[model samples]
Target: MNLLRSQLGRPSRRWAAIGIASAAVAGLVVSLSGCSSSTTPKAPENTVAQGQWPSYYPSDYGTIVDGAKKEGGELTIYSNTDQENWAPIFRDFQKKYPFVTKISANNLDSDEVFQRQLSESATGNAPADLLATNAVQAWATYNNEPGRVMEYQSPELAKMPDFAQVMPNVYAISMDPVGLAYNAKLLGGEPTSIADLAALVSADPAKFKNKITTRDVSGSFGFTVSKGFVDGNTDAWASLEKILPSARPETSSGTQIEKITSGEYLAGFFISSAVAFPAQDKAQGIFKFVFPKDGTVVLGRGIGITPKAPHANTAKLFIDFLLSEEGQNAVSEGGLTAYRDSVKPAPGRHTYGEIVDQAGESAVIRVPYKITSDADVKAFTDKWNGMLGK
Candidate 1:
């Protein structure tokens, strides 16, 4: 298996399909905005007041807000994130739209989110109004089918960077950086990069054996980040060759964090800041994180509304609000790295800008949103597992 063959390639069929539709939607959105034409939907007379909406929003953006309130004021989301992480965003969203009476958000495995969505939608049962995950490969496959994702464009698109909009309606809710985490009390010195960690492990293999952990690349989240790291810096494979012998791969970040905090594990590589940042306070200074100086893989948590969403309007509102400055801040508060430049920095919270500033723009490796061919995935997985001696 050649790592060079796995570098981010052409946009997948799903991306191309969505890209074409996005162009058409852009033209249509411009024409429809502020249009009093009979075909245009009108905001209901009882629509809630738009308080402090940014000046850049289209004049007719309120129609969607009004429509959402009429749709039973409920929203359900299926995502691969903890409920605690969603709490802040949920609290702030409902505060903005008091009309929203209920929100049901589930935290499931990365693949489980799509499995449930596909299964539920097939059985003619209502599925999630929105879907969120970091599994780019899974998302690409899911969107290959027509109508799997809604093609609506957000009014806040202009405010975001090109990378934020992964495909048509799909957007990145957070830009999370993957890094190394350690047990501060147990680790004698700070290791700034994978190579440094490898050097330390080489110094005392017995002390690190089975004590260092990383994501099991069999899973999408693990595979994506691990592959991203290697694709960005080929030198990572050399360091990993030295470290994997002493490493124990885990299926979840929670387990890695828990063991590291308890000193069961000495350190973990390719750990997500989204999971690690929030755990720091509870760890009481036991767990610490570092953005690898060699290269930092920044992964975008992909989110989009489902075409069959029971509450379509509400989902639309949610997506737009997430891209807004306030929503981005709430995302950061929830331990996710907010990507919007307008978002203010909070103590101990990370933003994409901050990561780039610290790691150097050239050192920031963005995991591209593309479909990995099954053969390619298998080849990569086989080689990766072989390295881990699995």
Candidate 2:
């Protein structure tokens, strides 16, 4: 089977398309609504036991365990993303695996997470069983020190296309096509493009001063913005930096977005499709998200088992569960998935493609990848911070 690529900037019904292809192979091709990978049928309910499954069972990681037992153990995962958002999925998973005795999940800043992981591993203490974080840092940590992450292929992963599993050890679970977000009430109307909004922000410093928020140069959102500037056309960058003086940078994307929603800041320089739009839908008035005609950046968060994981078996079980149809449904409900091939943006979490369609040709940008390496990222951040005098 040919591996299909994930289309980030455009809204391709890849998920629905793949379903049709599968049905065609089975001699029953047809177009369907809300019919995606999530709706795919499961293996026979009582077909195989957990321990008897073959290794590397599927091309991706789809057939490791035919079925998992309701067994549980303790696990500590060190993650940079919010655990509260992921809590519901974990709780549901607990229903399936009632034996899980203890679970420790903490949300920390990505930079500190990297520092601590490196520091702790230097010593004898292995503080985590699962490592779910921004792709760049995770890749850096795993590559900087080989054998730090174990390779246990889960069957559920095989259901995903090749883009979902970039590395055997790293499972890229969620993709966030990030752009600028604004408070609809304050703006009177949404800007036609990012450049236009930035110009407006720059022209009226008194009106928008300190009302523009962006992530600290050290975080992933900050990286997203910098990469955007680098990848965007001349007019886009010119307008983007015009608002730099009115901006206040925060340590986390959530904080930056919160400030924007509260009117403490009128807009965020870079916003995730998952985080920004979903939060807006719950707000009292209209709020808007913008993906300029320029391409938007797709930041994927990868989840994997740690190298020195004490609860290795349990950790693998958790990864498998996350890649399952049930788990992916929970993810879509939470408004964090950006893969056009699987779960799409829910009602509240506006999509990247939607924003671009609204902008038309004015929002000309490039979708930037290769921002995951340490040297490249450090250089980019340094240049980006210098622009803000940080």
Candidate 3:
């Protein structure tokens, strides 16, 4: 079977459906912000609070931070996270091990990173030593191509609480949940839940009819919402899509939160308090995050080792470092930790569980032991387009 063709089988235009929505999303942000009287507040520092993160994996053989044994090697990674956001973390890694040298990094979208890894594997020249991104993408890739990622099962893996340890190959160091975010001054405060918020939108269509925005979940969010539709919340999608004509799907949750704060968009969908709260706290735009009483989506960010990393040993060490308490804290940035039994995010618009539900990462749907299959990936893209009228 032609894997590439199958992967590309989904009409490209279906993927385009989301792009059309983005323009509106962007417009909503700009228009709403213009109406708000609030001023932007200062953002927070990157480090996480104390004792917030437990362990993402189990601690079978005690600690995973085996720093006592000094080892050295050059390593490289390719990712979508901008160099600026990631550079600090890399610097921290370097500070931990002054001996390692020649570290290289690249900034690219997850799709590009996945494609590059595939290309390298085809030519027996996988250059990067690590792979990291949001769980949905990584999970899909691993599912589609089992054994493409090396499995170290970090000694810290055992320390990870059960929910966080649901899958192999992909280990979460940080996570953010999806929920409704709104301008506090514009709507009194963030709605208690998505259902309530949706009701508010429907009741006064002119108020929020075209004021909300969302992220382009074409690959992951689409899969997430599809799974939600399949679940007992059969009406969840329709409930969600009911307001679509008025909703805009944007580039990311962060952008929507920014827009909402500025009063550009009064409300946003497919967002996590993780991004919203910080912005809200910074008083970026008088915003707040809240979950629908029913539930929402929880998405995680994590790291994985390439099956053919040039510096296998160093990559393994870095993975272990991240799973280590110190690294997890850095990733959490003093917010909600992803480890099992860890402290949950302070009361807000949503909870991690809500996101887990929306993203279909909860108890029912098994996160494939491997990534998604070539055929399935294509099916997902095509189905997304079908929904978008592509």
Each model's TM-score, in the order given? 0.82, 0.68, 0.68
Tens digits of lDDT, candidate 2, 98-176: 4554567665544444555668888978767887765453355454556867887767556775566645577765655
Tens digits of per-residue lDDT, candidate 3, 1-390, equal: 122211111112211111122223222221111222234322232242222224444543223333323333466776544332343344445555444544566655545667778887888888778776554644565546568778777766676655454356667655555566788789644475556666777777777756877555454544453344334354555556545556666655667877887777888765645455556646744777765445554455556788766677677666766666555543443343344334233222223444454344432232222355557766654644444311
lDDT of each: 0.74, 0.55, 0.52
After superposing candidate 2 on the true structure, give the runs of residues whose Cα lies further than 4 Å from its correct spot: 1-72, 114-123, 199-210, 218-221, 232-236, 262-264, 273-275, 338-340, 344-383
For every candidate in turn, the CA RMSD to the true structure comes to 12.1, 11.5, 9.8
Tell me how far the alpha carbon of residue 343 in candidate 3 is from the true structure, in angstroms, after superposition. 6.7
| Error of model 1, residue 137, in angstroms | 1.7
- State which candidate, 2 or 3, has the greater lDDT: 2
lDDT of 2 at 132: 72
Q: How many backbone clashes can be found in candidate 2?
A: 18
